[model samples]
Target: MLTTEIREAFLPYCLPDITDEEVNEVVQSLKSGWLAKGPRTIEFEKKFAEYVGAEHAVAMNSCTAALHIALLSANIGPGDEVITTPMTFAASANTIIHVGAVPVFADIDPETGCIDPDEIAKKVTPRTKAIIPVHYSGHSCDLDAIYEIADKHGLFVSEDAAHAIYTRYKGRMIGDNPKGAVSYSFYATKNLSTGEGGMLVTNNEEIANRARVLITHGMSRNAWNRYAKGGSWKYDIEEPGYKYNMFDIQASLGLIQLDRLEEMQQRRAQIADRYNRAFSELAAVKVPTVSEGTTTHSWHLYVLRVNPAELRIDRDQLIEELKERNVGTSVHFIPVHLMTAYSKKFGYKKGDFPNAEAWFENIVSLPLYPSMTDDDVDYVISSVQDIVHKFGK
Candidate 1:
């Protein structure tokens, strides 16, 4: 019913909420002359671990690197099968492969768009070494059920918590449980932005120690330790490792972002609530559901599902119409199983995971970020409503 004029410029799906605080921190890091793997990185790790109530946290270059290192540290390799959902970013599965492990595809919950515990239970075998359950779109997966399954089968659980910066399940933060490794992303568009960085949290002392060594090229000590005053140059390479250490420049941004995370998350929650309220009334669209009183959704992405049967236009047409109205949108994922790399490498096909494929056909991620203004939120809502009205069957 809104008749407001269309936005003159395109509205992006998401944007980092950078402020003078972040800029000042980065400037300070630059002026310090210790830009890589220095004091700032260590401080970020400590603060982030405390924030998530984790026993240990290791900073890395990316969430993919964190996952790869976690898998390697767990000794998961060839002939091992790691179960995961197809309805996720490819990095979730690719890291399993990077460690020479096979990624066993599991279908998602039709409603939650998260990995289904039932499907995971069905896929477990003697070859199963771990389960990489992604907290899809910042909604916590059924961790209790997943953990129960893991306990019964003696399987490791490495949470791909790229979208779950502040998400909680059963009154505890996602990384706090720490029975296994939990990886978080501070990607450009995440709830917490560091431009590019990640962290791995775990309760296992051995994994923590190994991750520390592995992130710094398997060196016995990091550069900051050797280069600082009263430092020793003597070091040793304990094992082969990847160059996954996070730099102080990125950590400087992370520190500022972390300081502002709660405020930013509040804004995101408001946007999500507004979107849910507005979209729930539309016949053609289904709003995302949150598990009331059970989990805290990070609200990282407000994914709306279009019931193609009720709309004359399909998901692609909906996206096009929104774009024409200067409203940006995106699909959370295309389902990892359908990607060429997975299909060609693993012999997966179109119908290998039915739920994921079906869900992929109708989901659209709306513009949700702390940077968006109230007018921007209204513009997106009105645009979507206008498009649905024009295209509804």
Candidate 2:
């Protein structure tokens, strides 16, 4: 049934799935009074490490911080190059620059929107020190092929797993047994959020220890509780670093969210399944394709690529129609290489990465979150199909 009704209330594109338990956790942290970056944050780090099967985890203020630390901990600095996809957020590339390294752009696998390993190989050079393959929209990149390239070139691998916390590569969790480091986002819209936080997980002790110091204003160990009862007040700055440590309040939320991750993820999966069934066979639409080796997808963003060639309306127009129909939408990315800063700095321009450019042109991210009800999901589906029927060639 094509729902001819427009919702009275406008559905948001995304929302944080916070429960009363999360609220109580924050209240408990506030009541505890030791709220800087204390017990709760440390506990979150430990629990997160265990959940992802990583030997160590360092919670940070943002995924960008983790990415910067990943490069810095490995001594990737000036005169070095880090290859990453232009199909991701600017932070993925910007973090490489933050570490005083050049960010080399690689085109994406058009079908999957993930960085192409072959393109990554093509971009590698004598100065290439690392590769930051983004797990685009919760579909794990071809880690096996990517790591093989890194091994051949003796390059470090810092995975941009902002969208892949629950994604599985070859039946292993995205953060499990990381090659170098895996950075995850905890932004309000992420699958597992702490309002605004991130975590860096790694099996390498050197990298993990370095990240802890780097994110805490370079304060030495044993100084974290310097203000506590019978605690030492002395510390040393190992090196100049950033103030990017996660706070207790955020971790308060994280602790509760982690406990409910599976429950929330099930809802996201159901919504994604609804979307796939609705659009996969539609003539003028293309649903996201879970790439090979991705044994499980996190269903972070249900990105639907509209075929403008077969539709009377294009991507932008579809967005407008959806808005009028009381459904909100977003775009996954605008391709980092095409952004003003990248173009002005690297002399990059459109036509540089044709596949990414084409993918961007036809894509619109529909709302996919645990908070949405079944009625909401069906309404969104009907709205999209109605538009297709009205506008299709």
Candidate 3:
């Protein structure tokens, strides 16, 4: 039994870990006067590339931009099929649509909530051109298996590492020495925050070069610095491209956040450990699972699954119960295939992917962030325990 009762105030599901240092850094960028993809953004990209052991990194306004540029740079177009899991944010599939390619939905490995490599293999055809495997909740996909399939079929692999900035696969960082391209999110909710930004990393220089041009309205090389010192006014337009560059202000937050990633991650891990310990004993709850291929999980979202048969309350009722206790919660995803856009466009129905649909019905992401205090962690754990005890069948 929990000794502490529910708190008086509502605990938010997410809040970026920010401090005076971050505020001061943003002020510094403002004072510097050059805000559009300036030195700071460049420096952050260089540091991020090195951090992930990639040869090149391009900053973008969002992960959607990075994912789109990744496909565009690779020449994946109409008539091409890009396989990705339906168990992710719509951005994963939306990017494929934006690239003029068909987004092929693959079911996930229910245990890890990542795209099943076997399912990916089954989706391959002569038209299949790429695979955008998302690392769900910072848990890595089966890279070895996915890559083997990619290699056999001569397909491009664009990893959607939106939740995997700190994730590792078989002891290698998710972006380290990538077989293709990897896109990472620096959204406010991520472990590393840039307010709203993303990075596309690759070891291939040609793709990197093209990605650079593709991000800034297709202006010729070095035009990003035309406004700075020793700059030239005249530049050529190579092709039509999107305005997706990250400004210095966001990079200012990114630089400091990147430096503090280890500290933030430690706190998140402690909170996760507490959740795991507390929830493992509950017959009605299943704690998030880290796949064997995942050497390190980024701990981006602490998702818990409730076995409906063991609980009198369904997942929605569980959320309401927690809400009544002043605890906030969220669902990681509601399978992309089931969304109206995909359903109406692609004829996807609920039963199309049973595993993903089942996983969706079972999950509720709890509050887990670096700023959460020990008391907050305990309260969340106790709150969950209380719910289970009250609702368990």
Report lDDT per candidate.
0.91, 0.92, 0.93
lDDT of 2 by residue, 246-350 (tens): 999999999999999999999999999988988987999999988669999999988999887789998999999999999999998999999888899889999
Off by over 4 Å in 3: 1-4
TM-score of each: 0.98, 0.98, 0.98
Question: What is the Cα-based lDDT of residue 361 in candidate 2?
Answer: 96
What is the TM-score (0 to 1) of candidate 2?
Answer: 0.98
Q: Is candidate 1 or candidate 3 better by lDDT?
A: 3
Which of the predicted structures, 2 or 3, would earn the higher lDDT when compared with the native?
A: 3
Residue 105 lDDT, candidate 2, scale 0-100: 91
Reference-based lDDT, residue 78, model 3 = 94
Tell me model 1's lDDT, rounded to 2 decimals: 0.91
The clash count for each model shown is 0, 0, 0
In model 2, which residue pairs have backbone atoms overlapping below 3 Å? Answer: none
